[model samples]
Target: MKIAFLYDAVYPYEKGGAQKRIWELARRLADDHDVHLYGMHYWDGPAVIEREGVTLHGVCEPRELYVDGRRSIPQAIAFALRVLPPLLREDFDVVDCQEFPYFPCFSGKLHELVRGSTLVITWYEVWDDYWYEYLGRKGLFGKAVERATLRLADTIVPISEYIAADLRELGRTAGLEVVENGVDFERLQEIPAADADWDVIYVGRLSEHKNVDLLLEAIATATTQLDRDLSCGIIGDGPEREQLEADAADLGVEDQVEFLGFVEADADVIGNIKATSVFVLPSIREGFPNTILEANACGVPSIVVDHAENGSTAVVEDGVTGFITEVSSEAIADRIVDCLTDDDLLADLSAGAKAFGRDHDWNVIVDELEEVYSSVVQRER
Candidate 1:
């Protein structure tokens, strides 16, 4: 089957959970199918190139994905306009478009209508009420766009039950398939642990939704509670880095926290995760966090906050693979202390985490996605 994926940012070039998901699925599916990805050109030289058996089309020149720590509307609109022409020229069995930055889904829909291909919209999150928080009064526009996008595709794949539930509440019932995010278990197993170790680590973009500031506060509290030095490594760069660094200094945990900004290699990221005793994802909002599974695959337990919007809690087996605490610095601190001081508990959680990772391997996820594509194409035929 020939498959096409649409998103503004490409993987490895622009690091994010959704980008990684598309890259992993596209590359693996390319082994047996004709897979193509259309996105902003983060690479130089040519608009089209082949990498790892998948064809990548640079739909437009790369634009700043974020402006003032939020997704740039202009950038999304630019990609949406540029992507339509290329999409209209090609025909594929499945064209899967990421749901966020909603404009491009219309392009995929247009292509589906023109080429008679099955269009699939993969939803990471359904920002209904949250749209208000994200955009204030203007969020009504965002909400309307989201609702309209839901009806564009016959097949809508939500990455978690949390997202699926939201989609249902928003009047989407038919063709809603819950396909969870996954980890690269085999690749993680091969990478050796980094030489340096940390008491705790957080790997992801430092954005407002991520709540890295809360992690800084927790690290400070954990240091005070532990008495001895407690080191926390923050791996990943984003808009909030400077503010987060300042927050760490204000909390007097600057020495205790190290910001290792965005390690390029997947092996290095996994290696660092392996070296950590505990992985912390304090984000209050998440569709499906790929970092949790990645850490679990590295035999490191994760600590996630129990927030209604945080769908990552689904993958975590509370008290077994990891602990889920309320969305508070104090609560997170307590979990950090528990994982760091209690050697027996950490070992048990680590074992449980590895098992959890194995269960959600990317290979299994890809097989499920392949079935969805095939079923959609068959039904369309």
Candidate 2:
């Protein structure tokens, strides 16, 4: 099958969830099928390039769409519309619409333009009341657009059982299909031993939902109550950095926290997780976090808030591979203390975490995604 992956950014340029998902699927699927990746242009960048047999096309002023972290919705929409014609002319067995903002609606419109074809809209995210906590939730104007895009889609792909349930509650007709994010099996095994420097590690985008402030507060409280020199390593970067840093200072835990803004090297990421006594994600929202999977693969236990609405719900069995707590600093601190003081539990978690990751190996996870693509293509015919 000649598969076309539609998205806003991909490959060497982007490396977060959206980029990771599309790249993993395309690379894996390309083993047996032809794959093309389409990304909206932002700054008059490269017109075309091939990376590992996957063709990339960038159109639209995606770069100017945002200036100083603020965006112009009108320009973004107009740009996506402008890039549609050339994309629509392409031949594809199936078009996989990745993430939201622009990819799904834009690609869905293109799929509609092509007769006798299928558009499988993969919903890594959706808009809800809680989404007001983060930007990119479909606003009133975007809401109307989402309805049209959802209606036009041939299939709906939800990343987790929780998201599937949410879609059902909203009464969307396309039954939800579960396909999760993945972790590299061999590379995980290839990772050097975890470092022993930091007591706790947090790896992921430093966004609002991540609630790094809460983690800082918890670290401060834990340091005071535990009466131990517990240093934390925070990996990743985002808009919340300044506020989080300020909060750490205010909490008097500046010396206890280290913010390694966005560890680009895998060795750095794995090393931190390996070094830590436990991994932590105080995110208020999530969608199959790749960080947890990576940590679990490395035999690192975790302390996460159990809000399924954020995709953290099914990441693991609570109290097994990792412990899930309420979304609060106090709750997170208590869980961290438990993991720290309890040696037996930490050892058990260390083994259990690695064991849990085996089931979510990319080999198994991507096969499930392949099945979804196959089913969607078959049904469309």
Candidate 3:
């Protein structure tokens, strides 16, 4: 099947969880089907770039509304408008839409107009007034658009069960299924054991949404309570770096925490993660964090908060695979200490984590996706 993946961002151009999922799925599905990713490019860059046997079409948009400190959405939309006509004419069987708000709000009509084409909107993270918190009053547009898109979609596949519940609350009585993104089984399993270099490690964006301050607070508590001998490694970059730096100092763990900005997706990340004993994600929201998946693949356990959205809580079996905590710094610190000190427990958790990750193999996920596609296609015909 010729699949047109409609999304906001993708790999190499962007490094978020949503994009990573598209990159991996397109590549994996490429083994049998022809997959193409279509996104609006805000920056004045190349129209086309290819990787991993998949073609990436970037519609150049004006650099306004600089989202995530990168490409502009306005230009990407205009570009999508111009480029889409030609591309959509090229005989794709189905459109796999990512980001609910965009498909319905930004590009709903396009899908609706495409007769006989199955529109599968993959809901990664739907905000519960989360965007309005940042984007202000006009964020109502996003919510309305998302609702419209959800209604128009032939199938709504939320990455987590919590998201499915949200769809029900919104009163969109559509066929909502919990079809999560999968992981790279071979690359992750191929990782060789490495020595523990950092006492603690975090590999995600340093942003407000991720709650970087709380992580620093917990680290400070761990440093003093466990003694200030251990080091903390911060991987990935974001806007909240300075605030977090201050928080680290205020907590008196400044010297112990080191922020390593934007590491490449290579063996070094795998090795660094393998060298760490504990993985952490202090986020207010997430669809299904690929970092946790990657960490689990490395046989490392995580310390994530107990938010009931998007499998953030479901990822960890709490004391089985990794520790799941309430949104508290002291609570997070205590879990870290427990995981660090107990060799038998960490070993046991690692065993459970690896097994759980195996269940999320792309082979299984793609089969489910194929089922969604088949169902959509049958209904469309």
- Ranked candidates, highest lDDT first: 1, 2, 3
The residue-by-residue lDDT of candidate 2 on 172-243, one tens digit each, is 856568887778867788877655588898988777778888899899878877998689989887778888
TM-score attained by model 2: 0.91
Per-model clash counts, in order, read 0, 7, 4
lDDT of 1: 0.91
- lDDT of candidate 1 over 257-318, digit per residue (tens): 99999899988888888889999999888888999989988889999999888887887889
Which residue runs of candidate 3 sit more than 4 Å off their true CA positions? Answer: 40-52, 61-76, 100-112, 192-196, 308-310
Q: Report the lDDT of model 2 for residue 372.
A: 83
Instruction: Give Cα distance to truth, residue 88, candidate 2, Å.
Output: 1.7
**Residue-level lDDT tens digits of model 3 in 210-325:** 87788788887887787656678888887788878888778777888888888875566777888888888878677777778778877789899987553576677788789889
Better of 2 and 3 by lDDT: 2
Scored by lDDT, model 2 comes in at 0.75
Model 3 is weakest, by summed lDDT over 10 consecutive residues, at 100-109
Q: How many angstroms is residue 18 displaced in model 1 relative to the true structure, after the best TM-score fit?
A: 0.7
Clashing residue pairs, backbone N/CA/C < 3 A, model 3: 42-72, 61-75, 61-76, 62-75
